[model samples]
Structures are given as structure tokens and as C-alpha cells.
Target: MPQIQSELSFNGLSVLYQIAHLLASGKDLELIMSNILEILETSAGMKRGMITILSPNNEELAVDVARGISETDKRKGKYRPGEGITGKVVATGRPVAIPILDAEPTFLDRTGARKGLKHSDLAFLCVPIKSGNVVIGALSTDRVAVQDAVTLEGELRFLEAVSDLIAQVVQTRRRDYDRIHALEKENLELRRSLENKGKPDLMIGNSSSMREVYRQIGQVAPSITTVTIRGETGTGKELVARAIHQKSPCASGPFIAVNCAALPESLLESELFGHEKGSFTGATAKRIGRFEAADNGTLFLDEIGEMSLSAQSRLLRAIQEKEFQRVGGSDSIHVNVRLICATNRDLETDVREGRFREDLYYRINVFTIALPPLRERGADVMLLADYFVKKYSRLHDKNIERISTPAIDMLSAYHWPGNVRELENVIERAVIVSTGNVIEGHDLPPTLQMKDASEQGERNDSFENLVAAYERELIVDALKDTQGNQTEAAKILGTTKRIIQYKITKYNIDFLRFRRGDSTGDDE
Candidate 1:
């Protein structure tokens, strides 16, 4: 029986101990593998050491780490199961030793590490790396061919032991990696929930109804569905359309907005579908239509209810076919655009009256988003007012900071008939006329003091009743702002949580109503 020299056996033992220590010390897998290969080359007289791991499907082997190998060679060093000598070891769960590589007909140097060597000087060894009873990968190296077969066999055994150590480390890391991946997925879901709890950027609202709107935006933004936004005029329909476009997959592409109500039937048709040079009277140049311009992006058509029957027919065909021809041009032009339509009119009523096509309405209304008017939105009135105040103040370069209490009262008491647009206009005009940093009640239009004439004599209309109603609205707004967190709401209002709790109980306010989903953000 032949034996490894005492000095070589001691060196091998030392290398194995150090590798085991590195794995135990929690070094990174890539660094440990690289260090292991270096040890084999320097201490064990093995050169060009390589490690390959089996893909999860076990169809091919991929080089995980290697010494004296270029990135180009490493990328090309893939082998199907049982295709090469290294692949055979991993497939059969056995070791392979080629004492004279040139003499072996099956030896294939895929990595090209041994270009000019023959059987007399170069030898190769490959062993399976097994985790328990399953082969997971392989480790291979080249060395000087020894004359005695027993000496080479002993060396192969030592390599097999090293391969086992590598397998153990890989198995442990893979388990840890799977656990971390699951945790990250859970964290992503939590973050999405929190995003829904409040107003996202580019939108303003604290009401639960508007939170639902935000949720809708989140759901629809990632898709290319045709969205029909319905709301009262001036209720920020265009902004909702823009939000959808900015979040969709076509966000990087162009965003084109067309106000269907602003143009005549003839001009609208030409504008939307494009006209060729001299197609009609005054056609000077070939114009690309909205559809072509908005290709690979989003197209927003506002006031869809205002489009004429003649134009609507052409629009329907363009959307359904995803292709159209320029006016006076015969060539078919194809376009890929996400369509968003908005209407303040009751489209269903129009369809019933035979003024709008039912088929066309259904085509664009694949996903409908109904925006609440400012009056029904409750506390969102003051929120929008404050936002407008800050926006115009910055634009007009004013030092305005707060809205006076009396002004807030007038804002809350009177109903806004024209919705958010009316509120924004009122604030812009007030900001211009006000002499002080605070917008006083007198700075507002007199029309606000006399509520709407239509709503006159509808209730008791007492001063005390008005004040109590205003207080309730303020508290409800604060609760919404804090997502029903009573402590945070009190802090925002500069009051104590106990007072907030008392008022909540007395007013029969359900704070949970302000919460959008399964959130424990509110204090019990």
C-alpha cells in the first residue's frame, strides 16, 4: 500500500482545517471558494483549480469559481449533464481521475486552461460535491502526472474530502438565501399597504373616499387597460389621467392630452387622426396625429362625452383596431398607446338618450374610476384650499402661510358648486388681494358668506350649530390626516389625545372609517 508523505499529509490537513474555519467564521461564499482554489494550487501542487455548480434543473453545469481563468472563458465553460468528464462526476455521484490527460480520448478542455499539454506531464482529477446523498456540483484541478497509480489515487481521495466541505457550506448558504428572499417579499407588501394609508405625492386628500381613489390609481397604474374617469367638472379629472399615465409601463414614453370639448367636429377629427399635406383647405404640411405622437406612451382624451357621433365612430375604430390612416393617406399606420378618457357628463344618460354610442362608451370604460365632487368629499375642501394657497403663494412670490379661522369657517360652511377648480380660483384671487400674510375672512368673496341661494332655509341654521359642525369637520379632517391614529391626530391639532377620544365618542365618530385597509396604525 502506498501512503502520502507525512509532510504532504500535514499540509493537506492544515488546508482542510483552515477552509473549515473560514466556513464556520461566516465568510462570503464567493470569497471562500476563491480562497479554497488558491490553497489547492499553492499547497497541494494542483494548478488551474475550478468549481462548477449544477443549475436547479440539473440540466447544465456553470462555473462558480476558478483560478487562472478569464471571465470570457468562465462564461463559455458550461456543460450539459454527463457531457464532459467534469459533468460525468456530478451526474454519477462519483470521482474521475485522468492520470495522463492526453492519453484519455474523453478529456475535453472546454475552459482551454491546458492548451499544449500532453499525457506525460499533465494529469486531471474531478470529484462530485455532495450534500448528504445528493450530488450538487463538482470540483476539478490539474497536476503533474505521477508514475505510481496509488500515489495519484490517494491525492484524488483528499480532493473528494475537500469537495464535501464545499458542499456543506453551499447547502447552508442556500437555505439562508431562501429564508431572506421570503422575508423581503413580505416587507414589500407592507410598504404597499402603508403607501395606501395616506395621500400619495401629486395628489391631495385625507378623506377615506379619496384614499379609495388612490388605491384605484395604484391598481390601474401598472396595467395598460383603457380607463374611463367620471367626475364633476373641475374635480381634477385631468390630473387623475396624468397620474395614471405617469405610473404606467409607458411612463418613459410621451404623454399627450386632448380636450375633446375644445374643438369642432371637423377640426377635432383632423387633429386627433392627423391630416395629410393639402388634405383639405389650409393643409400645408403632413401632421402626425395624437395617436401617432402618443405611440408607445399614453393618450388622455378629456370630456369624451362631448365628442360628436361622427368623430366617435372613427375614434372607436382606431382604438379597436390599434391602427389608423392619416387623412387623405391610404397607408395604414399602427400605434401602441394606453388610452385614458374622462367625462363630467353622465355618459349612461347620454347613451340612453341616443346622443352617445353605447358600444363606444363600453369600449373606453373597461375600467371606470369615479372621482367624488368636492362637496361630498367633506374635509378635502380645506385640504385643497390650503394646497392651492401654498401653490399660488410660491408662484406669486408671497409670504402667505396660514388661512384665518373665519376664512376656514366660510370655506367649510358654503358648498363649492364648481368643485376643486372653483376652490383653486377663489384661493388664487384671495392671495392676490390680501395685504397680510394670513388670508382673512373679509378677503374672501361675499358670495361665500351667503351660502348657495339654493340651499337656503334647509335647516335650523343657528350660530352654535354652525360652530359645532365646523369643529366636527376639523376633528374628522385631523383623524383622516393621521389615518385614524388618535394620538397623532391630537398632536397635529395641538390638543391632547384624551380630548380627541372624548369628542370622538360624543360625536359618534368611528375613527376606523378613516383607515383604508387592514392597518393597526390607529390606537385602540
Candidate 2:
């Protein structure tokens, strides 16, 4: 059997392909729609192609895109639902075609675009743009008439297909707008909550040490004073910098940060202060530096102790005089930036050893804030762990609820050499490994399981300690052998099920972890 060809002409197919390419390019939706109208007018034998979008309140249709129509006429074209041929299609969710526009008295020339053309010389085709069975808008185009019903029907079918494509783009843009609107509302709410409570909700802690840090941030955030943050690596110095910037008078300005240790001495000067074109061998174009980019905002210099002595002299001049010349240029540019610096190395020791500039150190050390390590924060560990568990569970799309008691004990007992950053990594990894709602001790890395020599030596033969340790070991072994079956585990241990249940509760063991392919088990 021979296949029948489509009524779409070769030029019409080419125009549709062009419209599809524009959609796939991910250009601005308004520009894409305008180009589609242009293609329909020039190549598809259609004139005055127009796409009208529903207003925000859904009260009327406004011309969003048009071709071969005057600006005045486009502005005049507004239709309510069921008002005319274009409005009727949107109201009824159907397509309409007029073979002879002159005979149709209902063809309201609201746009005045057909002022000189007679009704017998043109045909009108309109289709509803639907999103999931709901008509959101309409697409209409007119063509010069040969006064035949079959030709008008074919053009109507082609226009209907184009309307479907337009509907998809409209729905995608609507969903994206809704998502962004929701996120902006959430951010505003959080900012309002912080202002109402007068607290630094971004940093999570309530310990005495953290309280002092908060006090420092509150004292200096609203001013333009320079700050120097002293702490070990992974102590969240960047977070403190951001909190300061957010609360400062320049909250709406840019915040630029650079690591002094990341670049070599040769490139550090250009990286911080920028350079003029043709200044060096590879300097073919002019560049803007961090100091200039951060003007009217905050500039955070991380690892400041690693800056070279030559760079230190230039940086001191820029800070004290509030100006500096670009590399290989004599023009001094002025800047008004609030500077915040951080370093793990002791700057006082560096000054005494003649490695760092004493004058520069005094200039940047106007105010200092120190952050404590994770091991020193005490109960804050469990709080941070809980926060991280929730964060990673959402990111990984898992159902991890909370850390088990035994796992919390293990986390609190270990000395965090890498500080809070290390703890975050450990929790993130455990969230990935956990199979149920609760994170167990077995889900932790092996390094956390190994007891240090001091801890091992401290476990003396106390009456309660020895009994608890032995009982925990026996229960774990039995549960492992029986594949997490409580009845079989009790029989193997030669004890009643009641005793086994009591022991499991006392030790906080997650027996379901041993079961095969059980990701949704009840936590006991």
C-alpha cells in the first residue's frame, strides 16, 4: 500500500524546522516567538502572524508577539474570552478557520490591521494554545485567499501543530518562573527571621565560645572596621566573612575573596592589583583585579600570612592610602573596600622571625576574631552532625532521619584533627552508606571505629563497664550470625526473647542493618 503525503508544502516543512531549531537553541522566549512569527509571515505564505498571551489575572489576551502588524494596531488588539473569532477558540479550546473573511461579520478587526484588505481576499486561521487541557492563550495567522475550503482546512491543521509547540514553551517558562519566585520568597523570609530574632542563624552553635564570636560579629558588622580572622583550617572563617559582609552597610555590593597561598609570587601582584595591557610577556589585554572588583563592598584575603614581602608592601600602601597603581602602570586607582583577612599561621611569630612585615600586620590587625575547633565545642558536635545529616539527606534524596546514639558517642569521642570540615565529610559519607532512616555506628568509616591508645588504656575493669562492653559484643555477634532475626538471635544466645529485646534496647543496636535488602526497617 502507498502512503499518503502530508498537506504541508516543502517550504512549510522547512519553516517548521527553523522554528524547532530556534526553540532548541534555548534563546530568550520572547525573541524565539518573534522569530517564529517572522518565519510564518515570510516563508509559510501567512500574513500578520500573531501570538497573544493571557494576562497575569487571566482577564484578557494581550499581543505578546506579532509580524506584519503596526505597533499602534498591536497595542489596540485586546480581546476578552469569547469576544471574537480569536477569543472564541481560546474559550472553547478548539480551532476555527474562515475561508472568506468578508462574509464573516463576526471577524472583529480590533487590531485595524486589515483596514485596506477586503474580506474576500483573505482567510483567518486560529488555534488554542493548551497546557494540559487548559487553554492559556491562542495563535492566529492570516493568508491570502484562493477561496477554497480544502486549502483553508490544511492551513488550519498546520497552525494547530505550531500552537502545540508554543504551548510547551509557555508551560516550561511558567514553571521556571514559579520555582524562582518560591526561592526568592524563602530567602526573604529567612532574612526577616534573622532580623527579628537579632541572631546569626547562618552559623550554627550556642556554646560560650560561639557566643563570644557572635558578639564580635555583631559589634563590628555594621561598621567599616578592618577585621583579621585567626583560626585553624576548616574552622569556617569564610562563613564569618560572609556574615560580616551581609550585615555591613555594603550588603548589596560585591564580595571578593582570594587565597594568598594559591598563586606564586610572580602572579600574586597582578592577581590582587590587576595589570595594564602589554605589561608583561603574556599581558596582551588589560585586566581588573580583586581589589578593584571588590570596591564598594568587602574583600576577604584568605591565608594572608603566605603573601610575599614585596606584595605585602604594596598591599600596605593600598590599605593605608586607600589607593594603588596597577602593575606596570603609574595611574593610582582609588578604592573604598572593607577588608577582612584570615590565616591559620601565627602572624606574631612571623613578625618576630622577620618573615612578615610588622607594620602591615599592625595595619590589618585592627580587630581580631578567633574560631574554636570542633573538639572544643562539646555538645555542639551533635548539633552540627544533625544539621549535616539533614542537608546531605536532601541532597542525595535519601530518608536518613537522625544519627543513632552509639554513632553520636563515636563521633563525640574522636578528636577532629581537620575540625568541622572533616566532620561534615564523615557525615556526608555515612548518609550515602546508610540503608534506613537512622544512621548507625557501622555506617561510619573505619577510622572512627578504631579506639585510640589512651581510650583503650582508660577502659579499666570497672564492674558496669566490663559487663556493658561484653554484652554489647555478644548481642552484635549473634545478630550478625542470624541475619538480624531477633528470634533466631535469642535462641543462639540461649536467652529468652524478652532478655534479647531488653539488651538490644540498652545498647541501641540497629539490627536491621544486618538484614538482606531491608532499606525500610522500623527503628527500635
Candidate 3:
């Protein structure tokens, strides 16, 4: 068959290729959109352009991108859906091309597509980027013409192709978003399943202090002793509570925890004992209390020292009698929950200060566990650091293989005023931010280091700059040897065109200098 007359203009093909390459290159979306408009105009010879899409709420179609249009003109017709040509295509789910404007119909150009007002002798073409029979968005481009039918037909074809490309892009984006949302929801459920006593991986330490804690947990976790853990914040007190329950025969039961300091007294009480329907304003339904939720399991009260004295008194009675009434309910309910309390404050001192209950302290102090903070854990920091680095790197999908030697030294030397919990948080942050395969000193937070963060940032910047400069020099030397021809240079360096281009951009290598075109701005 003989070749047919081509409608795909050379300029339009170039623009399409550019857009496709940009989408393929995986560049950030904002940059891709910024240049897309100019490229489109160069190809299809459009005077104005607008890209509109259905919002996430699906309540309205809003303009996400527009070019050749002004803000004032947009106000007149810029922010509505199915308004003019753009809206017609979206609503009808079909392309609309205005060849001669019919009888010069009034253009309610809500898009202000090009400039701020309606154009003279304006011709328009709009196409819907439909996905799965539903129009996700519309692409409209206008031109200055006197309603020439043949010219409009060719332009419409150009836009139809653009619309097809756009539809694929939109469908692909929606799929990626749906997949990500599903993964996030799944991870949230998994996190809820894995978490216990507010401590992740709640394992008991083998140290002497923790051994005693374990012994107490073994003794009281099975039996119903209102076990209260005493230690500073971030000391693995909650972990000890979890350990007791795991070791106890009630290992099959739920392990529920509530931070007393985090919630208000009313909410905390309701959380613990639950509330009857109509208990208070916004109590739409009867809610199960934590004790009822953790029935036959262990109930952990973290920051118990901060709980209200009245709450503590009620809590003490529940501990002694193994029963309690819900808030605003007259009926008393019996529960078989084992109580485990943790506190960073001294309850006895609180008792003396007349803030905490003496009776409640005595009841919960039946089994006491005090966790030594991380600074006193001997080589445990190194042990936990290694364990956490590996665990969290996999969790965050990071490339970190291990902590560097200097990082280890810093970890070990740090006083850890906040204890094991703080160490975990710092390591997690480093794992998130660090780009290298290993955790370096600069990766750690400035508060964790001897040097200020700004100083550390500057030092890292300087070092990176030095390295980049050295690499640029190496590339330039290779190119000179190859007589400024990239293919030969790449062969000489045993690389590819892509790699050379990357280095050239990274080092800002000047080919013109090597080409003998000019020595101007050689320093840059």
C-alpha cells in the first residue's frame, strides 16, 4: 500500500514525543506540567489551553492546569465544570469542535483559556480523556481562525491523539493511587495487630534489673496482682508489663494499654470503665471500656502517676474487688482482667504530695518492675541499635545495610537521657532521611550529636561539592582524550550516553569549551 498524506505534523509529533518521554522518565509531576503547555502550543498551534479534572471528592470538576489564560478572565469563566467547550466534552463524554462558531455564539469561556477575554474569530476543539466510560477530565485548546472547517478537522485530530495519551496517563495514575491507599490501610491494620502495651517488639531484657522484672511478671502475670511498673520515661517499663502478660498463662488474652497523660480525666475514665448510651454529650452509642475489651487479658495503664486521684481511688477498688461500674451506669460488671500499671513518676512521692491515692498505689505495687534506662544497659545500645536498624530499614523500604563505625561510637557514647524509646526514634529518623547505604554521623539528628545541625549540614554539603567537582574533572579529561565526541568518550570511560549525560548535568560540564567554540564562562 502507498503512504497516505500525514496529519501528524512534525511539530506536533515532537511535542508528543517530549510529553511521552517526560512521563516515561519518572520526573516529578509539577515540573512535567509546567513545560507541557508550551510544548503543546508549539505542536498543535493552539492559542489557549486548559486541563480540567474531576476532584477527589467527585463533587466538582476543577481546573488543575491551564495555559495562555489570565486570572481575571478565569474568574468570569475559569473555575466551573461543563461550562463551555471543556464542560460540554466532560458532560457529554465526547469531543466537540467548533468550526465556524455557527452564528458566532457567545463564548462563556469560563476557562479564560488564552488571555482574559473571549477571542475574536476564535475556533475551539475539546476532547474528553475518558477512562472506563467515565470522563475523568477534558482537554481543550483554542486557535485564532475564521471557522475554517478543514483546518478545525485537522486540529481536532491532533487533540484526539493527545486525549488518548492523556487517558492512559490518568488511568495509570488512578491505579497507582488505589494501590498505595490499599497498602497503607493494610499496614495500619498490621500495625494495630503487632502493637502491644504501646511498645513495639515488647521483649524483656536479660539484665539483672529486667530479670527481677521478668520474675515479678512471671509471678503476677498469671495471678491477678495489680502489677505496677516504676521507672523513668522511655525506660522499657511498658515492655516489662507486656512481658509479664506473655509469660503468664493469659498469653492468649488481649493486651490493652492507655496513656493516662495523653487523654483527659473524663475520657480516660470512659476509656477504662466505658460509658452507657446517653452518658454525656456526643455519646451516640454505648461504648465498651478498655477493661471489658481486655477481658481475660492484661490491661496496661501507662503514665499512671498522672491519673486523677478520684480515678485512682476507683481503680484501686476495681483492683481489690475485681469489679467496677461503668460511667453513668448503675449496674456493676465483673471482669477477669489482669492489671499492669507503668509510671515515670514515683507513686509514693505522689502519695506524699497528696496527688495520687495511697490505697491504689499499695494495690498496684504488689508486683513492681523497674527498667534500667538505655545509658545503663551496657552493650545493649549496640545490640538494640543493630536490631532496630535492620528491622526499620526493611519496614521503611530504605537501602541502609548497617550503621557506620562512627555512628556506632556516637550511639554508644550518647548519654541517652530519654532511654531506649528515644534511641529507637532517633534511629528511625536516621533511617528515613539517610540516602547512603550506611548510617553516617551526619545522618543522625543534631540534638543527638556534639556538633550543631547547621554545621553538620554545611560540612556534608562541602564534601559533596568537592566530590562532584572531582568527578567533573575526570569526565572532562576523558572527553578531551576522545576529541569531544561523546560516543568515543563513553567508550574510553566504559560507560553509556545516559551516564555521560548525567555526569555532564551533575558537574555542569561544558562541551563548547572542548569543541573550541568558546572559552567563555569556562569556570561554570
TM-score of each: 0.52, 0.52, 0.48
* Model 3, span 317-369: residue lDDT tens: 78878889988899998999888888988777889989988877777777666
lDDT accuracy of residue 330 in candidate 1: 87
RMSD of each: 17.9, 22.4, 28.0
Shift in Å, residue 185, candidate 3: 17
Report how far off residue 111 is in candidate 3 (Å). Answer: 41
Query: Whole-model Cα lDDT per candidate?
Result: 0.83, 0.83, 0.71
lDDT for 181 in candidate 3 is 69
| Residue pairs with backbone atoms closer than 3 Å in model 1 (clashes) | none
Residue-level lDDT of model 2, residues 1-524, one tens digit each, is 11223765645567667888888998998788888888888788788888887754466887767887878889988999888988888889888988888888888978888888887889888988888788888999888765666776767777877787778987675576566765675466447635532344458887656776897899999999999998999888878987898899987766677999999999999999999989998997788788997888899999999999999999999999999989989999999999999999999999999989999999999888989888767678898899889988998999997899999989987888888899999999999999999999999999899987666766565467656756776777788667678888888999987898888989898887567555333334
Q: Which stretches of model 1 miss by more than 4 angstroms?
A: 1-200, 459-524
Query: Which stretches in model 3 have alpha-carbon errors above 4 Å?
Result: 1-207, 451-524
Clashes of each: 0, 1, 4
Sorted by TM-score (best first), the order is: 2, 1, 3
1-524 in candidate 1: lDDT tens per residue?
12334535447778778778777877777888889899888888888999888866566788878899798888878998898898889889889888777677777778887766665688889988888898878999999886554657778878887887889876665566556765664455335434532223558887866877888899999999999999999888877877887788987676678999999888998889898888999997788798887888888899989999988998999999999988888899999999999998999899999989999988998888889889767789998899989988998999899999999989987778899889988999899999999999988988886767677786676676667766777788898778798999999999999999999988888898677566567477
